[model samples]
Target: MTTTRLPLFPLNTVLFPGLVLPLNVFEPRYRALMADLLELPEDGPRPFGVVAIRDGHEVAPSAVGLPETGKPPELAAGSGFARDDPRRSFHEVGCVADASTIRERPDEEGYEVLATGTTRFRLVSVTAEGPYLTAEVEPLEEVAGEGAGALASGVLRAFRSYQKVLAGANERSLAPGQDLPDDPSVVSYLVAAATMLYTPDKQRLLQAKDTATRLAEELRILRQETAVIGKLPSVPGAEFTVRPTSLN
Candidate 1:
């Protein structure tokens, strides 16, 4: 696929396609970005990339190797740092999210916006355009059709089991099998993000290129979560509440 330039927001959390992320945007740059997005035509997919800043904070451009010209660092082909490297600046692959719903804070300080991931995009380069960072990116292709359904089903079942365990641990009830999308890619993303074990695990799932790979990774996480849950007391209390669905 031909690559295109996109505005980027480097965050601490990972976002997956089809998952909804609520962001508190307070910085002047992001406020401008949101304003520009609101002005764009909303007919097609209104998307932007969300990449996790690897080493330094996203709010500080100087930490991510912003050039003397005050431009965002370019992600060229020779860039050889691992995504998990603490020295690296950002993740190469990120999800494109549509800013579907937004509510501006009355104080005019920031906005509480709800964004839904629409597709995966790879960062080819990044440049500072005024306040926010922009990236050259390409859309990642979906998994092959032949095995998508099976992979998705496996992931859904695992997710169901995980949710059950979570509910049991917290003595809470969850409406299982509620309004899940039929698409395999979407299902994989939803399950992975919904059943969060750790940030790194979620990041791995988000970076997985295909449905099959993502399903396998999610199953592994579910098994690990189950094992950890098993070692704990069966008594229901706020202990299990430490890991809430809101974090996921």
Candidate 2:
């Protein structure tokens, strides 16, 4: 029920709780974000809101030398930059992430950050008055809804079956030897992250109302995907790897 302010980072991918995100931050705006996180108290958690981009590019066009008019040249021409409504560029529901490690590249181009998703939040408002986007968000509760434990068990079995099918099709392990967690919420998120679903599908999983809801949906998805993969002649290569907000 409580609301909090967080720096916002919009990317093309969706993040789920307990999933680790590795970011290659080279954009000026995001590089600034990394610098701010590096300045946080070493012992305290450095958190940010990571929302998926609804439209437009994650890397913005250079706005330098453009007149400070009502719209930037790209906005006026409709071809130079992203959408004018910054708020519309990103999804409203997102995950909260904690930066565990931030290392500066040798060339100082940007930072290589390792972060893990922690929780979910609904965006209330976004502001661009600073170097990067920031938002006021209401935290989403991690409720273990009715029959979550049973649903979790079903999901795990379905996921194992999915992994086998996917491996046969793709000839690769998603993450071999990774011990799957047992807590319902953890299981829900872990499956959501590890699954090879599209970004929209993953976002839907992240936005599920509770653990049981997510598990139920995942159970259906796993079965559906496994069946489809089992029928496939061969699977194409996919980018399986799966980013932070602003600072003043």
TM-score of each: 0.77, 0.83
Q: Which residue segments of model 1 deviate by more than 4 Å?
A: 42-44, 60-87, 168-174, 177-179, 235-248
lDDT of 2 by residue, 1-248 (tens): 68999887787788888888887665666667788999998778999999887776644422122223332222121121244556677777899989999888786766778899998999887777677777899999899999999999999889888787666344334555577878999999888877776677888888888889999999998888777766665544222221011110
**Lowest lDDT 10-residue stretch of candidate 2:** 239-248
Could you give me the TM-score of model 1 versus the true structure? 0.77
Query: How big is the positional error of residue 27 in model 1, measured in Å on the Cα after superposition?
Result: 1.2
Could you give candidate 1's per-residue lDDT for residues 1-248 as a string of tens digits? 69987777777677887777777765567766787787777665567788765655644331122224543343422133233332257877788989886667786655677888888888887766355667889888877445778777776776676666666444333367587777877787777666744555667777776777887776777777666765666634425533543221
**Model 2 regions lying over 4 Å from their true place:** 60-85, 171-177, 234-248
lDDT of each: 0.66, 0.74
